[model samples]
Each structure stands twice: as C-alpha cells, then as structure tokens.
Target: MPKLTLDDLAKIREKTKRLTTIRVGGEYRAKVCVHMGTCGIAAGARTIMNALMKELEEREIHDVLLTNSGCAGLCSREPMATVEVAGQAPVKYVDLTEKKIKEIFEKHVLGGKIVQEYALGIGSEKTDY
Candidate 1:
C-alpha cells in the first residue's frame, strides 16, 4: 500500500479528535451500533443507520457517534442494535426497522430513558459484553 501523505495524516488526526470529543469527557454521550452482517443488511440495517444519523442531527446532539459492527451472535435478530449512555446500563434493541429507530432515539437518546419493552436487559445472558 502507498504511504499516507501529510494531508491524509492531518485529516486522520482531525477525525480522531472529533471522535474523542464525541466521547464526552470520559462519559459516553451515546453509542449506536448497527449490525452489518449479511443477515443484518437484509433486515434493513442501512435504514436504521440512516434514521439514527438523522435523529442525532435533528436532536443536535453532537456528542453521539454512530458505528457498524459484525453480527452480535443473534442472527435471528439480525438487525439488532445496542445503545449505551454515560452512566446507565447498555440495552440491546432488536428487530429494528426505520420507524423503531426514531422511537429508540427519542426515548433513549434524547429523554435519557430506556424503552424497556424493546430492550434486552443489561444482565441478560445474551449480553456478551
């Protein structure tokens, strides 16, 4: 592979700083993971990611960040996602469609509330992390 130029290095540094800021001073402002395995894409992970980005923008919460990861060992719930707040426990939300993404954003991200019905409990055996 070609060596990275100075400009490329600078851009990478800028992005690193931005990502650090989004972590919100040791507290995670928000963490959204969109499962991106083959099954997940088939189940609309793309739409979920789009909705999440739109909601984060609309809420004007610059600290939140979005990411994609491989399957979370739950292919039956292919498009599964997890949200983790600074102090609160992480919650897994399954069966995500675009509409549900908005609801999750509103209740969980903006309001600092967990949609319990949709949330797989923090201590559930399925939780690997």
Candidate 2:
C-alpha cells in the first residue's frame, strides 16, 4: 500500500469521527440510509446519495451518518430513504429527485422537521437513545 501522510491520516480520522459520532449522546441525530437495491438504483438512488454527500460536505454537516442499505421494501417508491432522528419518529421520503433531496436535507436533516409532502410516513420504531 502507498505510504500515508499525516494530512491524509488526519482526513481519514475526521471522516471516521463524523460517521461514528452519536447524535444524542449515543444516537445519531439523523441517519440517512439510501436504498441501493437494483430497483432503487434504477430509480436514481445513486444520484440522490451523491447529492446528499455534496450537500452535507458543503454545509459542513458531519453528524449525520450516510449509509446505504439493500432495499427499503418500497419498490414503487424506488429511490427512497429513511431519516431517523434521535427522540423523533423516523420518516421515509419517496420519489426522490435532486431537488427533493435538497429540500429533505435542509428541512428534515438540518432543520429537524420532516417534509410531509415528500414523505410516505413516519416509521413505527423509535431509537433507544
């Protein structure tokens, strides 16, 4: 493997810290999981995921853990995501577009408010933290 420099190591550390940081003492303030199943990919989940990463980086927001899961089981809502916030009900947004992802990031992720119009519904499970 190529030798890593101090700067490179620091950058890696920062990213790891961001991903592992807990939102509410021990839970993520918000978790953004993109469904990468075949159907989801066909629907543009990759675009949504890229948009989300850019948005978060530009905003210097790192508390949110950006992850990908196989499928959300909502094929009709192919490019969908489940935003789980600490102490609040998780909301699943459907039919995502680039514009919609930004709205969800600004309103739901940053502002701590769910975008009901784009959301299918709040999830039943709650976080233990």
Candidate 3:
C-alpha cells in the first residue's frame, strides 16, 4: 500500500472538512434528509437517496446539504424525506420513489416551492420549551 504524501493528506483533510460542514448545517441554502431506517430501506430509501445525489451532481448544485436519519415514526410511509430550505419551514415528504424524489429536488430544493402533492406535512413538531 502506498503511503499518503503530505499533499494527499492535506487534500483529504480539506475534503473531510467540507463534508463535515455540510453535515453540520453550515452555510447551506437547502437541506435534504432521507430516512434510512430498516423500514425505509425496505421501501427503497436507498434508491431515493441515490436519485437525489444524482440530481445534485448533474445540476452541479452546491450549498445543499444531504443527510439521513432513522424512522420518522411512520413505518407505512417508509421511503420518506425532509426538505428544508433556509428561512423556510421543513417539509416532510412521504412514500417517495426515485421519480418523486427527483421532482421534489427540482421543485422544492431548487425552485423554492413546496411540492405539496408529495409532502406529508410542513414544519417540525412544536417543542414545549
């Protein structure tokens, strides 16, 4: 195995930092969270995630954070995702497929309009605090 040179290490560190920033909700314009729990995977969450990734790459879209979380307590709506654009409330989209996810990305993430047809709800649960 070839040892990494100093330059290679620096590059790796930079890449890692960039990704960490995105995951930690850095100055991103939008955020997509795909539910990847067991039920979600069974219902094709992986495919949904891949489709979103492909869209981001094809459009060369930066400033959008992609992430995953566990089941959203709606097992029936297995393949679910949440799209949150900065300054707007988060929208939970349910029963998603690759096609639906792609459309959601274009309309909601990029176009800044909620795709109401596929959206389960808007905004997170209210906290007592």
Candidate 4:
C-alpha cells in the first residue's frame, strides 16, 4: 500500500463520518435513507440521492444522516426514501423525483413537517431505535 497523503486522509475521514453518523443516536436531527435496489436505480434513485446531497451541501446541513438501503419491498414504488426525524415516526415517500425529494428534504427533513402529498405513509415496521 502506498503512503496516504493528507488529502487522502481527509477523504477517508469524511467517508468515515458519513458511514458512522447513523450510529451516533440522538446526535443527528434527521435520517434520510434512499432505497438503492436494482429497481430503484433503474427508476432514478441515484438522482434523488444526489439532489438530497446537493441540498445538504448547499445548506451546510450536517445534522441530517443521509444513507442508502436495499429494496423497500415495493418495486412499483422504485425510487423511495424514508425520512425519520428525531422523536417522530419515519415517513416513507414513494414514486420520488429529484424535484419532489428536494422539497421533502426542505420541508420534512429540515422543517420537521411531513409532506403528506408525497408520502406513502407515516411510521415504519417495528425496529429498535
């Protein structure tokens, strides 16, 4: 292995931080999980994820954990995401577009209000918090 430069270390640090953010319970204000399964990608999940990332970067928002998971089990709703705000139930939004997701990030993720128009449902399957 080659010696890691300072720039390489910085990149590693950022990647680590992104990966570990979800584990630091109560530290983050919200969590956005984009479903990136094969169907999801074909339906444009990548675009949705990228738009969310751009929103976060432009807003300099650090308290929201952005991540991805496998199929949401509803391939018909391929490009889906779940947004969970602290102390609130997670809302699963389906049939997402980049434009709609950016609105969700702004209203639901940042403003703490569910965007009912785009949401499939509120609350998720039982999971240990």
Candidate 5:
C-alpha cells in the first residue's frame, strides 16, 4: 500500500479532532437514540430530534451520541427518545415534544436524574458476538 503524505496525515488528524467534537466515540458518556420510524415521523419525531440537537448544541455537549433508530413495536408511542448513559440502564421516553425534550436534557441528560412522568421504560441493549 502507498504511504500517506504529510498533507493526508494532517487531514486525518483534523477529521479526528472534528469527530471528537460532535461525534461520539466508544468512550462516549451517553447516547440519545431517537426513533424515526414511519409512525414516529407522522408523530413528529423530526421535530423532537431537532429540539434535541438544538439542546445539545446550546449546551455544548459533545460526550453524547445522537442517533436514530427504527420502531420499538410501540406505534402508539411514536416520537420517542431513549437515553442511555454509560454504566446505567437506558430510559425510553414517549410522547416527546420540544418542551419535554428540554426538560429531559436538563433533568435526565445533565443532572443524571430520570423523569418518570415522560419515561416509558428501560431500553434493551444489543450485543454482538
């Protein structure tokens, strides 16, 4: 294989640094998974996700991974969000709105407290062998 030049190396370094900013690595402190299934979309999942992104940006939080997922077989509970912190059980929230999202960010994400009112249940983890 051809060796990478200094310019290429510099570009790689820059990309890595940028990834650490808005990107989540294996050492991420937490993850926010937004359900974007068809039902979720009809129920305003996009808006909820935008609200979440705004909150993360406004708070300048970088240790959290924000991702999207399919349905959780709870179509009635569309526009849901799941928060999974390192070393802690993931909590799924239902009927999410912008206001509720901010509340979740403040109470659950930042303060490490779970909001039972909006919370649905614990999210199951995926394991790869």
Candidate 6:
C-alpha cells in the first residue's frame, strides 16, 4: 500500500470512531437477527432482511445493526427471527413476513414496546429483575 496522506489518515480515523460508537451504543435500540438457513431462505428470509434494512434506513437509525445467523432450531416454522433490546429479553418471532418485520421495527425498536402476539417464546415470565 502507498503511504497515507493527512486527508487519508483523517478519513480512517473518522471511520474508526464511527465503528467504535456503533459497536458500543447501538445495541440499546434493538438487535435483529434474521435466520438465513436453507429453510428460512425457502420461506422468504431475503425479503424480510431487505424490509428490515429499508425501514432502518428510512428511520435514520444509523446505529442499528442488521445481521444474519443460522437456524434457531425452528425449521418447522421457517423464516424465524429474533429481536432483542438492551435491558430487555429477546423474543422469537415465527413465520415472519416483510410486513411483520416492519411492524417489529416500528413497535419494538422505535416505540420501545414488544409485540407479544407474534412472539413465539418470550422470556418475560422467568426474569427476576
């Protein structure tokens, strides 16, 4: 690689700062995991992921992170997803659609409220805190 100029160094520093900030402070809003295993793909995981990305972008939530993971052992209910907010329990949502993913982003992420009706296994009852 060529020697970095002052401007290049500054850009690198700025990107580093942004990445650190995102890692440390972003989890509070929501952590969304879209299962993208074979079963999930067959059930439309791509559309769900796209919807989530669009909603987060439209909302201007730059801190929010989108990730892909393997199956959560719920292949019978393919396209399963999970959303976990900082200081709150993670909730599993089954048979997800793009519409429902958007609803989850709004209600759970923006509104700070869980959408219980679609949750498959909520750990709210077991928590002592």
lDDT comparing candidate 4 with the true structure: 0.89
Tell me the lDDT of candidate 3. 0.87
The CA lDDT of each predicted structure is 0.77, 0.84, 0.87, 0.89, 0.85, 0.78
Candidate No. with top lDDT: 4
lDDT of 5 by residue, 17-49 (tens): 756765444467788899998999999999999
Q: Ten consecutive residues with minimal summed lDDT in candidate 4?
A: 17-26
lDDT for position 128 in model 5: 45
Superposed on all Cα atoms, model 2 deviates from the true structure by an RMSD in Å of: 6.1
Clashing pairs in 5: none
lDDT of 2 by residue, 28-109 (tens): 5688988899999999999999999999878877668788788777789879988877678778889999999999988988
Model 4 clashing residue pairs (backbone): none
Q: Estimate candidate 3's RMSD in Å.
A: 5.2
Candidate 2: clashing pairs of residues: 23-27, 23-29
Model 6: lDDT to the true structure? 0.78
Q: What are the runs in model 1 whose C-alpha is more than 4 Å off?
A: 1-27, 123-129
lDDT of each residue in 1-129, candidate 1, tens digit only: 659988999999977776577555644577777888888988889989988988876765667768788777778886888887767777888988888878888889767898887776673224345
Which ranges in model 2 have alpha carbons more than 4 Å from their true place? 1-27, 124-129
The regions of model 5 sitting more than 4 angstroms off are: 1-26, 125-129
For every model in order, what is the number of clashing pairs?
Answer: 0, 2, 0, 0, 0, 0
> Which rank order by lDDT, best down to worst?
4, 3, 5, 2, 6, 1
TM-score of each: 0.72, 0.75, 0.78, 0.78, 0.79, 0.74
Q: lDDT of model 2 at residue 15?
A: 79
Positional deviation of 75 in candidate 4, in angstroms? 0.4
TM-score of decoy 5? 0.79
Q: Is candidate 1 or candidate 4 better by TM-score?
A: 4
